[model samples]
Structures are given as structure tokens and as C-alpha cells.
Target: MNPSAWPAPAAAVANTLLVNPTIASRASARFPLALLNLAAALDRNGASRIIDGNLDRGFIDTALDALAQTRFDALGISVMGGPQVAPAIALSRAVRERFPQLPIVWGGYFPTLYPDTALNADYVDYAIRGQGERTLPELIAALRGEGPPPAQIQGLSWKLDGAPVHNPDRDFSSDDAPPLLPYAKLGDPRRYLAPTFLGRRTAVHQAALGCRFRCTFCGVAAMFGGATALPAAQRLARELGYLKHGLGADSVQFFDHNFFDREADMIPLLEVMARLELPWWCYARADALLNLSPATWTLVRKSRLRMAYIGAESPNGAMLKEIRKGTRPDQTLEVAELCRRHGVIPELSFMVAPPHDTEAATEQTFEFIREIKRINPQSEIIVYIYTPLPEASRHRKDRGKRAAAPLLDLRGEPVVFPDTPEQWTQQRWVDYACHADAPWLSDDLRRRIRDFVTVLRCRYPTVQDLRSPRWAKRGLSAMAAWRYRLRRYDRPWELDLADRLVRLRRPQASGL
Candidate 1:
């Protein structure tokens, strides 16, 4: 058993269990840093009997077993803001049935956004609205009968006299950022697998929190607001070194909503990162790429920014504006060109069959994708049907009377947009592109895009399967058969050219 935080739990009042509910996808299960952060906070407040129930490691029974054996004052569940809610609800029910007296607390993006729904549920006893780092420790103190009254705790939701009571909101900018998660307390980080970088041991760490842009379909802004900030550059560099040298990670994946939002923070971080000699990848907006200076671009390349996952929602300027992407079609193309020039792979993604999707919009999307294919056949293109997020739905005025799931995974969770044609529901666009060979584009372009996704899913099944070992194995088997049948397109010469295109190198720095 893992030892307590310092001075062990004095009694049941100071014990806590941090549960990471099973997400349906393997891709979603990285290091549970969010839960670990809360654990560290709870530890500082004298809760040492902390049990980590990470379901991603195995079955629900394992987590339940941990809960059964450990003596916990409060049970906390961290859930994503989408389909994972279903699993979290089920886990809460099971826990309630077994330990009826223990208080059940829910924290995370889903609970933060939908506190009312989470609190009203039969199982959840408390909901932490914004950041749980501070709120969680305060709640633990109250549970120990040592801190302020429960009603005075900010950003908390719980029952009072059998009625739900919501405390006043906390100013996120003013709230103290929690210290680094107790990484050592959590078991070996290597067991936390990320299949994308097959050879290198990768760890997920956030450079910053919140987002600058408020796209119609994103919940980051809703949860954390537009203003984003990061720790001091030297501190960030130290953290990266710890992950690389301390945690045995060879690569780092930045979970920041947008890493390059502020030039002051990004450049210094990249400069320090260059010395660390670690390859990194992050999510960024196209506009951020366009706004970067050539020198800054050079510095980024020196820092080994291997790939950028950009949200190029649509190719049409009007649709881009409608979705509040704040990027023009030409600018996106320019961003791609710059990534190529700087020796970086810009993995561009697009949304299809959305509420605003029309025949003309479809044509624009195809045209945009076709152009990118011509420019960089090595680059990746991801297409998804527009799944409406709860907060985004409110901002979308033109979406005529469409019902959307509260939370969902864009890859699966079948949802039909309000404006999608009857024939195009359930991702029929992909079928038409792969099989029908729609009249608008040549068969070659459609074939290229289809093959891109097929090859990618095979190479990184975790993205497709999320984290289900069963599904990952099944996908690998299917990919083998697929390769055998499509031998014509898998020729050495063609594949060599594709690799050359995909792995573009940057111009060497003058001094280096």
C-alpha cells in the first residue's frame, strides 16, 4: 500500500480516495495529473490515506476493491465533460450502494460546467465548480471539522437541509495555483502508456490553463475563461527536466488548450526547452502560427516542436467566422506553409456535417482538403462530424431546433446535427468519400484522404480505440487485413515518397 502524505491519517476525518473513472477510450487515459494535483493539495492539508482508483489501469472491479479496502472520509471522482459522465454515474451508483455513508464528491470539466445536473444526481454529494486544487483541500479541512463552515467555501456545491446550495463563485485569476502534483506518490509513470510516440516514453503536462479563443463548440473558455497564464519560465523548464530526467520521459505532450497564445510565455519556454533536448508537441490555433515572427519560428524549430495539432475547423471563410475560429482560409494555408518551412508537421483537422453544413460548405471543405493534399501529402487530415457541446449550443443561433448530447466523443457517439441532411447522418460523408467517389472531386483525391486516415488509425490505434485493449488489438488485426487487400497502394516507392513528404526537415540554425 502507498504510504500517507507525511504525518499519516489521524482518523477517518482526514482520509480521502481520489477516483479516476474509466473513460471509454485508451487515447483519453494519460497520466492522471488532474487527480494527482488534487491529491497533492489534500496531502498538504493532512489527508494521507489517499487511495488512487485509476480505472484506466484495469477493470471497474479493481477500483471498487480499492474503495472497499481503504478507509476514506470522502470519495472524489474526476470525470471528463463528455460521454465519460455515463461511466462516472455508474461508478458513483456502485460506490453508493456499497458505502452509503461516505460522502461522494465529483470534480472535473463535466461537473464544473454542469454542476446543477451533477449535484441533483442521487449519488453525488458535493461538486467543485472551477479549479478543485484549492476547493478540495478546503472541503477536506471542513470534513475534518477544522476549517470554516461548509457554506462559506467558495466554488462548492452541496446539500443543506436536503436542498442543494451553491457557494459564491471564486475568481480564478486570484485563486492560488496548486503546486506540482505528487508525481512520486503516484506509481511508476511508465505504466501510463501513450501509444502515439511508440518508442519514446511520453508524459502529459500542461504549460498553461484556459484558452484565448471562444470557438462556438469548445468548452475551455466556458470553464476557465479567455485569460490564460503560465508559471515562470525557469520553473516550467525545471518541471520539464523533472519529467524527462526524473519521471523517465523522453517526450512531453503539452495539454495546454493553446500553448502559443502569449508570445512572452511561449518564446522563453521554448528557449529553455531547446536546451533540454526533448521533442514536444502541442495544440495551437492557426492564427497563432500566422502571428509568429520568423525568428520565433526558428526558435520553435530549434526547440523540437515535432507536431502541431491545429483546429482548422473548416476551409470556408464564412463558416470559419460562423464558428468563431478567427482564422481565414488563406491564413490556414499560410500556417501550413510556415510549418513546412520551419520543419514541423502541422496535423490539420476539419469538421463536417455540422449545423451550418450545406452543399456549398461541403464543396469548400473538400476544396480546402484537396489543396492541402497537393501541398503536403505527408501532412495529416482529420475529419469529424460536428458534435454540439452544451455551452457551444447556446452560442449557435442558426442551429434550428437541434438536440445534442450533453457530452460526447466526436469519433463515435452518433449524433446528427440540426442541419445535416437525412442521408448524411451517422458519418455518411466518409462513406460517400470512400465508396461513392462523389462527383465533385476526382477519385485520386478522395482515395488519398481515405488512405491517410486508415493508415493513421493503424499506426496509432489508441486515438481510435481511446484506451480499450480489446478494441486496440481488434483494430490492429483489421489493419493487417486491410494492408494485404490494398497492396496496390502500399508499394515501396509510393510509401517512401509519402514518408519523405510527411517527415519534412527544417533548415539548420546558422550557429548550430
Candidate 2:
């Protein structure tokens, strides 16, 4: 491809359009933080616009109208692996059909995990893997015949003569003194502030990037390659102050892949939060929480931390080590008690069913969850099937190292993963991505897990469900108390029927 053959750079600054095709309901939808960050970077030298499909039911047509009206150099789509893939495909195909010449770039977790699969489609002109803050601007400039050719761009996958060509992966960026995300691009930013258990107008922010641990089953590990970076204290203070004062956000939900890092490094940020005194929720590790110094814990309490979501992936210590999840089961139990004492709810999520020892592992996890509930009745439990990423989907740095064992279905046949975006739209594949179901799960085992979950949730209706009435929750709890006490979690037909009437919200689905 010759640079000279491409169109000349426009006299005015280039404008790029970003679309977030997440298929979540409006009530559950939070801010599209990924697009906002990209838009902020693009605004430095060029302008960018955001179209959030989660809030806009007619986003496809809206995006088409925008493209037809405005002169956009490129259309960047933020996609995730599961339900978002179908909408992304629809939007990409629609834009390509309507405007035949515009460049379509796909980014976010979907492209980062499967770059070749993303580039395999005729609609996707480029797939920006890893961080797109820097890659996107460079690619946009290159498309305008003003920068290096496509082959030179790092962390990019492009088709060369109808063949996918992936360049070397780019190192993670140092998030030192990063600019504030352009929330204004989303049109009244207040609309993104949702009502969660934290507060009435809860805003989501990511003060840090990536996770240091390389948990094999985690998409974050595959996307970030075990690298993590925290924001400067001043940057966090500025952002939080703006969100509170400028935007009227009463609470915050930190979407950091891992919020709590080293104790010494976290003090300044904790101090900032303590001063703000905003009720907050964050994703934390059991080990990290247990290791926090007494002084830091004081700061955490002063900050009014309402809840901490910890991934206690499994009760089996050996399984934890196998997945490279650095935390131990003991730490999980300890954190439950610790959170109880600190007046913070410990929302612990566990991966119940594993490919190997499927039944035993799941049953053990169920027992472990019961023990946690006994230790701290306020502890919240979330269960997910243990679904490991395909070897090919892993980060290049960790792909061949400590490769996963071959996975087998219940029929003893090797489990195969989808190769293209369209295939991922299948119901089974979507369920797999969401960790709701797995290929190795038998019909009996699936029903058992569902029945157990029904009983467990009914016994202790989650505090996060603001929609469900108080009388309904208490009635469900009284009805489920006997089953939960007797451990009769099999075939919970009565609880299931009652749940349908109450329509309780699953916190796992919304991540609130």
C-alpha cells in the first residue's frame, strides 16, 4: 500500500467517531469509560465523538446519520467478546454498506483477544489491539497519508493483500498525569450516572489500569499481559472533585481491573478519597485487603467504602495456583470476616465448575460459600462457571508459557472455540463468554447449580436490588430459610417460581 496513493490530509483537524455497542439495558448501563478515554486522547490533536448503544436503542441508525452528516476520517467501535459482538457486527456492516469508503477500526477486548478473527471480516479495516489511546490517533493519521504506513504501527492488525498482518505488541502506557476523560462527548454526562447500592447518582471511574496478576481464566490478563499502573494522586483528586462538584455525582464505582495495589503506594489516593468522603465501591483482591496496614484501613473506612468485590475464584488452593491467581482460599475467608468488621460488604465471586473434577469442585465451592456465609452472614456470594481462555486468545507474552490443559466436553470430546465474530454470537458461545455456562457442564450439573443459586439468592436477597420491594425480599427469604438451612438446594422449584414473581436483580449480570 503506497502512502502517496491515499487521500491527502484534510486542511481542518481530523474527526473520528467512536461507537460503544454494548447491549445492556438502560437501567443497568453506566458510562462508556473506554470510549471517553479514547475520545480524550483523540481530542488532543483531533476531535472525536461518542455514540453509546447501551443507552441509545436506535444507535445504528443514529451512527449512520452522524456519518452521513459529518465528515469522519474513521469509525472506531468498542467491542467486548460476548453479547456486544453481535451489535458491533451489525453497526460495522451497516456503516460499511452505507458509506463504502470510510475506514472501520475495531478495538477493546474483542479485538485484543482475537486480532486475526477481527481482521478476518471484510468490514473491519483495522483492529487496534491493547491500548488504543496512542494507537488510534496514529492509525487515523496514517489513514490520512500523514504518518507511518500500517505495517509500522505497533499493536495493530491489518489486512495486507487480503492476509491478516499483526505487528509486534505495544508496551503498556504510563498513566502519569493523564488528562480527564471527555464526558461531555456523551451529551449530558449526568445521564451516565446510575443509581446503584452505593448512592442515588453513582458514577463509574477507573483510577488505575490493568491487573498485575496473570489469572489464566481472566480476560484482563489476556488483554494486559499482567502489567498494571496506578494514577497519580493529583489526577485522581482532580477527577473525583470534578465528578462530585462539577457533575453532582454523590458516589463512585471504580472500574479498575484491580483497585487496591501496594499499601504504601495507595495511601495518597486513600487520603484523597478520605477527604472527599464519597461512598465508593471497587474490585479488590482478598490478599491485598488483608495486607492493608491498620493506618490504611482507617483511611479506607474514612473514605466510606461501602463494598469490595473480591474474586475468590475457587476454594481449591491447587486450582488457584494452576490458574496463577496469586491469592489463597484462607485469604478469602479472612477477608470475609475482615469486611464484616469494617462495615463493608464483601461481595465474593467464585468460579464453581472446572473442566477437571467438575462435580467435586462445584460441590466443594458450594460448601465453601456456606462456610463464608456462616462466618459473615452479610457476605455476598456470586457464582460463575470456570471458563478458561483458548490458548490462542491469550496475550502473546503469556501464550506458550504454562499453556492450559486441553479442555474436554461432557462427551469426552475436545472443546472447540469459535473462530469468527459471527460464531461468537451463538447462544452457547455467549453463555460461555459470560461464564453463565460451560461446555463441560452436564445437564444434571447445570440444573443443580441453578437450583442452588435460586435457593441461595432467595435466602439472602442482595442489597444491590433497589427495585425489588422490602416485603417481597423478606417473604422470599422466609420461604427459602428452610431449604438454605437444611442444604436442600436441589430442584428448588418453589424458590424459582417465587423469584419469577419478585424479579430480583442479579448483581453478577449488571456488575453494580
Scored by TM-score, the top model is 2
TM accuracy, model 1: 0.74
- Minimum summed lDDT over a 10-residue window in model 2 is located at 1-10
Question: 88-108 in candidate 2: lDDT tens per residue?
Answer: 999999988877778999999
- The lDDT, on a scale of 0 to 1, for candidate 1 is 0.63
Candidate 1, residue 133: Cα displacement in angstroms equals 0.8
The total of clashing pairs for model 1 equals 5
Runs in model 2 deviating more than 4 A are 1-11
Distance from true location, Cα of 3 in model 2, Å: 23
- How many residue pairs clash in all the candidates, one count each? 5, 0
lDDT of 1 by residue, 351-415 (tens): 65554333456546756765775676445566654544544223222233233333322344434
lDDT of each: 0.63, 0.90
